[model samples]
Target: MKRYLLSLRLFWTTALSAQLEYRFNFLIELIAMLGTLLGSVFILSLFFSHGNKIGDWTWEAALVVQGVYTLLDGITNTFLKPNLSEIVNYVREGTLDFVLLKPIDSQFWLSTRTISPSGLPEICLGFSLIIWSSNRVSNGIHFDHIAIFIISLFCAIIILYSFWFLIASTTIWFVKTWNATEVLRAVLASGRYPVAAYPPSLRLFFTLVLPVAFLTTVPAQMILGNINLLKLFTSLLFSIIFFNLSRYFWKFALRFYTSASS
Candidate 1:
């Protein structure tokens, strides 16, 4: 465990150093992130412009959902996209052999080999929005609520990573899964709005099928002091299931791997 921790530090430090070399890119990313966030808020405002509440969610509450989505999206950009997207290329080019040969776990090495600071601003802004909006709706943040929110948010992140890795693992059989990843992204985009805002059919689909509700809405609700133990338990259960499924799928896929030398 200590060795792995040391390795993680080295991996991120190296990645951060490399990213810093192109410092101007950070400014570009920050500007783009701000523009996107503002545009999202503008569109959200249009829904409540005429005193229309989305489902039972007030504007502030809805912003909490958006904040959670943004936070997850930032994580995707920072970690999942940079690392998981390379799985397909590694498979196609036979580079995965090198990865598998490493003393560390291949999944660990692949998933945490690099860090992108471009999404750091988005992450910071997401947390700020979540706190600001959540406080407006409920009494100022409670320690208990914050603790529960952190737990739910951690589950959400695990679920998100599992979904991505599940898709990425298919590279063992299908060398190009880019379209699948895009479809997942499109589906996940719906998470920016409260799940209740969706039609019944879509809401059920998002909750049971894709589990998008757990990704954003549930966490938002938790932070807003609407803590539902059942929902939180469900989220925790789903995260564990998804994560294990992804891990198992990767091992299964590796059984079929044929190195370039072969």
Candidate 2:
């Protein structure tokens, strides 16, 4: 474990050095991201100006949900978005053969192929929002709630990564599978708010079929003391099942591969 972590650190160092070569571009991108975040905060402010509660969530709770959404966004940008997109290109150009020949786990290599340090500011902003909201909550938060929220959020991240991987791996069989990732981005957008805010049918769809419930709502609700044991267990169950399924499916996809040289 230590050796793997050391090697991973080395990979991060190399990636960071490469990205720093374009320091001006990196700064510009960072500024643009900050502007987008401010816009999102402004919209949320208008939302809360109308009412204290939206579907049993107080304004602070809602803010926490938005923070979770930000964290999810940062995660997608930092890892999944760039690498998963490349996975499709690898398939289309038949360059995945180069990835397969690497000595390490291909998925791990693929996942860490690029790192977006710019996303770290967004992640920090997300945590800062959570802390601000928790401080303002009338009932106050307990350590247990925070602990559960951490676990639940980790599960949500795993579930989301697996779901995206499931979609991306389809490229092994269907070369055009890359475009489907845009649809995934749309679906995950629904997770920006509490799932309960949607109509009953949409709520059921997000909760059961797509996992937006586990992705955003459950973690925020857990932090706010609004979640139950069943919700926690179900989130864990979904994450474990999907993570295993994506792993196995990745192996399944490899069976269909043919080299670019062919």
- On lDDT, the candidate that comes out on top is 1
Model 1 per-residue lDDT tens digits across residues 1-262? 9999999999999988886777798568668877866765676567557555789998889989988988888888888888999888889889898889889999898899988865666687789889988988986999999999999999999999999999999989888999999999999999989999999999999999999999999999999999899999999999999999999999999998876555
Give all candidates' CA lDDT scores. Answer: 0.89, 0.84
Task: Tell me the TM-score of model 1.
Answer: 0.93
Model 2: lDDT of residue 63: 84
Error of 1 at 257 (Å): 0.9
